[model samples]
Target: MPVSLWAMEPMMPLADMPAMVLTPARVSQPQSEAPASVTVIDRNLIEASGARELYEVLKLVPGMTAIKVDGNVPTVAYHGTQARDSRRMLVLLDGRSQYQPGLSRVNWNDMPVDIRDVERIEVTRGPAAAAYGANAFTAVVNIITRDPRDISKHTVSVRGGNNGILDGRAAAVGHGDNTAWRASVSRRADDGYDEPFEGETRPDRKRIETLNTEWVWESDSHNTFALQVGGSQSRLERQQESGVADIGRYTREPVQKGERAFLGLEWQHVFSATHQLKISTYGQYNKEVTDFGVCYLDPFTGQQGPGGALLFSQELRELYSQNGGDTAATFAAVPTSGPVLSRYGSLQGVAGVNFCADSELDLQEERYDLEVQDTWQINDRMRLVSGANVRHDRVSSQAYLSGTEDNVSYRLFGNLAVDVLSPLTLNLGGYWERDQINGEHFSPRGGVSWRVAPGHTLRYVYSRAVRTPDIYEDQAITNIQALDMSEPFASNPEALLGWSPSYFFITQSSPGTLKPEKIRSEEIGYYGQFRFLELDVRYFQEELTDLLSHALNPFEFEPNNEGWVKHQGTEAQLTFRPTVNHLLRLTGAHIHTHTNKKTETRIAARDSGSALWAWQLASQWGVSTAYYFANDYNDYRYERADLQIRFRHRAGPAELEWRAVIQHALNKEPIVFEENQYQEDRMWLELEMKI
Candidate 1:
């Protein structure tokens, strides 16, 4: 294939490169001088990879795991602790948090910004509590978008491909003497995987719309102000089953709708060469609604019952009838039947008769945050960065919580850096935080970086991080309301009249409130830049305690902090660029975990690696290929390859670019979410024009 001339764009020289990190220290420091391990993915790599989604780009980061259970639902795990609701890591969009307090999960499908608007992504692959308070237990991801000044003209993009994928986006930027503004709108839809697991329904289908706008004003070099606003709406198809006994049936084609909006303002001022200050405020609102329904059979007679009713055993039904709706006695009575009732029954039952009640888990949350920070250059060798913030969260849910709940939190953090000697630097940082639900706690971090040689640097770091219990875990109220049996069995009172007329509630609450999960970590890292290669290697060990897990008592299933886990890992990344048009990148990680509970081991991969090759055949065309592999785990194992080809041309006043990407080129099927779904090969083509 012939490559385009643009594909031969010169790479930035390593010597002149400045520190591009943002999340590690909340300050721009040279990559070699940063205390923590950081990975930066720039726009050039993003464009060359031909990736259409944000999660796909994260695969390049060492020790980071990106799992897409379906097209619309994706989870990213750092340091080997993943779950259905991943809450250990914090994600930020241009410094604004995307974490939802109600669910404690990041809704990747509903993010306001499209992939085309993103300029770079910074990932800190370790505990970040010292910089960002609680919930930064494992790692942090910060996404930075292109500034108005960086957008030279208007652009439009359109993409279409297999599996019903279609996407469209339009962006425009305007500049003035003292101000600049940017606005963008995007719409995307995909059919997802065509084939679902046997007896299961397809879940990856999705449609989403988003809008984003930003304005900035630079009065002078001393002062600057910026404002940003974004909103998104998404509709996704999911397959979920009920957890209730005898009622666990697959819900095919269940649709979930989400709406989100955010507004932010930032101001910075330079008092002098020695002192600078910045203040930022942001507010976010999100609401999700899904019509979740299930079907079940009556436990006693093994006959299909009403779709939405909560049915009990024959003995409990008789007890309720005799006791006149006494929930205590009704629950105390044990089943005398020989066989145990199955939570998930066969799907062959009749529809209307086996239909359970129509229920919905509707969650709505609002958050407001304000923070101010100062950067002081104490002297030529010493610097200090300090900040404090206040946050308030309001959550309302019908299925998860009692009612509207309010949580207020406050945090104070500071970091000090000192150059003790010519080639050695020391950093110390800590954060103190207090919240209405979790009380008060403190986390600390310390590190030292040494320039062992002209091209090599070594770093040793120690840190502690915490993960606070989320709203659902701390105050969940699972209500199972029984349907009225009076009318159905009025003719035969003895058979059905004994059933309870009220609801059965399963509530999880702790008298002392659950303690936050805590982890202490120690790491040693080496970074080196050679004539044709750049290498980064790190070894880390972490001890985690007070982890949250469900109580073992059969009578109740509340959450408790009674888990201990230890993890040790080694990760490395190697980038070899022999010439301007040829490049090779290799990344690998090996992790071992010991846990008091056996289930935790399934969350992380034991070994994983990827090898990528890119080449510019000619000026107008380019090609890239990659192979990714992961050791077999309990749930899944995969080895897949990908290919991308790009073409570019000039059309009068507009520039046109086209790219085609093939994922899972070998057509391998990978199981995800306990074999409920399988990921299949896919192909997509994108065309973009800039004027």
Candidate 2:
């Protein structure tokens, strides 16, 4: 019988381990000798932590901030919170890009792969454009799944808990001739938080179903081929606002439906012991539909007029005439001066002229990518990796964009690592990229690692990365339903009357093609592994320019790249094993940022830390506990503890396992910034069987 790598006992000696990392330079390298700060979360820790969500797992990593906007939507940030969508970080699942081009956000709930299938997740704490091209601005997360060879049989798992949570998963692995395959299916549903704001409805309920499969074939020892396909469908309840005049209120319940699918293929050839080549291709499709319903009150009647249609009273007509110098003719025309007026008029007509209560936004996007890479071992002391990729993205939307838009991008990157001496290694890498929307740009990175002693290493790294504007940011034609006239306006004759425009249309017209946001970073790091402890520390300073932010005007909210920021931070992680049965880990981070925009850092905490302990109580039983703390960020401050326990036993021909997890065991209500939501403690139980 072969021992599973994931079945290894916890608290292994650091001196006996050689961790391999791939995100730093797009090539496998020793974690101790990597040029940047990298963190690896393996399956053992993942199972022991008993975290159901990917974002929850990230909370344990140093310098990573994971927070739930509600129960279903989570935002993960690496350093500073510049935006809500988390566009600065690049995420990949099994080498396939997970970044959505339309919203520039990773929809964690829509990810096709199940958590149980993930073997490891590698995180790079800083810029990695030299390896991942544009949009790898602040960090990169690479999720690697278990290979088919590692799975010996079929497995099934089920989970149920509070908040109407119900989850189930099934997976199978098999081999035929020279081909190996693995397939998995998962379904999850939750009612989300039960608490509601004063005037807001209960939001964030979500349901997701996914299927994933992969096949690998070895034609010979030197050549290999793999194919992967996956898809997901998700439904989420959203919170929205609706009303007339000054007495607007939130809708009871709004819903969003999303669907995504992807297919990928790869071929690898090993020419010799020192040379290799790989080719990969992938395609992805995504679509989402959201219904935003607003209700208008008749000024004269002082009652709700209709549910889905926007009713423009006489007061609104006069207001539009007073603002734009034209009334019936201009009001009949769409507000923005763009080619999309025809479509807008056809759909909703002029806001004041035509009343459409049920307004819906439809967004669809498709992307195809092809890449080829070569790796050459020039000598025992030197190696080089070069790659080129071409990608095409197309977006079609009615709410945010005027019309269908397509963008094509190309990237070329190379990295070189040379051991100048037995104690010193030098690394250099760069990427050149061209995109239809942002034109062309170049990013470069260089670093040196010095092994000062037998178990200690020091490194210095400098890198440049870029974040390109997303489709929505570059071309948004948003129409917002503001307010309608009420009894107060009707009673006040002096106020503008007879015109009740329930909606305001805002459009952004770029002066020219926008430039990509740029960042230059410098970092120093140290790593040491002693008898019973391992430590890693890094300090970094970054200069960010051409940041994309919103510029508000009376007419519209425009996207402008006019701000700069400076960020400095330190991250450290320590691991201590007092005995083979007990392991302890501590992680902390502190960041200081100066930005031209005040709101850029409003939700970011200045410091955060976590302490985790895992103990193997018996040969078949284990328990873990963790405490997390984050300093005050405006009105938001949090300190929470979590606990988990696992029990395993072998049946006649299968393995049975039972696990329990309790999140926020302290049951404290922490204030959240900029959002009117409540947090609650939750617990879950899971049972698994393997045959």
Candidate 3:
């Protein structure tokens, strides 16, 4: 994988703050009524936790691990799977998809909305393919922004802290009796780690700027219209930390930069008190330019063969294809060790000085989606929701795909819930989707919920889901077109014959070869609501097959789907809010993974938990303390504690709010990896005003 594919921070520790969610079954219903386990973080929880990024707040959810892959790019994975190329989950921003199909990843920093603008976040901690089709294999993260009518007239927020952290946001709202609109702009920057664990002065830094706006109009009781427009630009310093290619490498300025924009419109019509229809469409565009100069020595974390040969060269692959998998003839054509080294020089033959590859992971992706959904309350005991959507995705990447490719996907999904008996309810849903590349698939989900008592319920759910391979995974041609050599090779380029060519190509583009990742999940859950406390607990077992992975050695790297893995876990979340002045929240999960290879556990966590306690000391003062624990990624334990204080004051008609937070790592020395080690402590202070 290119360095740009390098895909959270100390968890801004979850308060069970929301009682209703709209993600589980695509309807606004009490959390207890949803078919899946749901966790919600409200704006109040966001304020008390002092979380500046979306992924930071996600640590509150059970069975979810949010971390920075290289202490720069934000990655949030449920039941942690391969994180560097985090896939299998679906992310939505106000009903619009935030995932890039081109890379099959989420650029959380480049998202237009700021943390302050988010009203609430709901996570469905299970497969949602029955409702969202493919790519909802593990979970769904739904971010709901503050409604235009609910935004304050004017708001400003600013924060600065250690590690070169600086952030600022400004928002304005304009509204009348019939219409409301909101506009906001924000900027954030951070200078990562003083120094890396292994290497000193690592080039790791990030900056992002965003502009967002929304407009809503109520055209009478039966009709409503909404429009949204947003854009963001981001810059990140990329550092390739490991392998011979990266060792002793000097720092470079900004290595990657990206810009993205989106436009959306929606119309809702209410035919009756119990029936409604919604039609929505959105268009999104994103472009990224990346630059890196590195030698092709060793790419994978684990070295292979004798000196980690660069055998997966495009020339050898082409020769192999041309010779019909005749390895003898193929190698004969592109000899590994000859006078000229044939097409690709042997790893033992090429020294560091004779190799230079102008590597770029540049790409542009565009997506358009249109959806129509209808909901009907057939009776007091029956509810039905159904929807259909079509998505068109276009990706252009000369380095990744070698050309432009477009695919159209169509999906039809529906969910029905009926009270079969006085205390039992049944939920049945399915999704049928057809994609140009992934073909057609139908996933079904069935669940039953029994209301044990007035405030308690039990649920059993079963679902089947799939994750289609991304464009880069299916049709990848990773290479550098321009090859620049130094010294000896520059003086006598022809002496090497046609070994290096004009450039060194990594993989020959292969389309329609890899299969989709598939999963089957079974869960038993319980929810209880009382006057003083609430509880949500779940036990789940997931079996995944045809997983996508490849060896790091370019010569041996071939995307294949034959792996099998199973994960079983229990997740629980509890909230104790006896009074409005005090609150206590706890969340935890324990998982055991059985993979084809035991050494592959680095992508999954064995145990994770968090606790938070808050007190309203006075009318204008409040304090909160949070702690997080997670371990078992190569047996590395991560522990962190957070303490925060909030203050508010009145200035004429405006209100001034202040927040200060301190986070410290509790682990003396936990080894996540050899190259990237997190700082021991981080701190920040924030000021916000509303007029």
TM-score of each: 0.89, 0.87, 0.88
Q: How much does each candidate deviate from the true structure in C-alpha RMSD?
A: 5.2, 6.3, 6.9
Candidate with maximal TM-score: 1
- In candidate 1, position 350 carries an lDDT of 23
lDDT (CA) per prediction:
0.75, 0.75, 0.78
lDDT of 2 at 28: 93
Per-residue C-alpha lDDT of model 2 across residues 361-449, encoded as one tens digit per residue: 67899999999999999999999999999999999975567568889999999999999999999999999999888888899999999
Error of 3 at 136 (Å): 0.6
lDDT for 165 (candidate 2): 81
Q: Which stretches of candidate 3 lie over 4 Å from their true place?
A: 1-18, 241-254, 294-357, 483-501, 551-556, 598-600
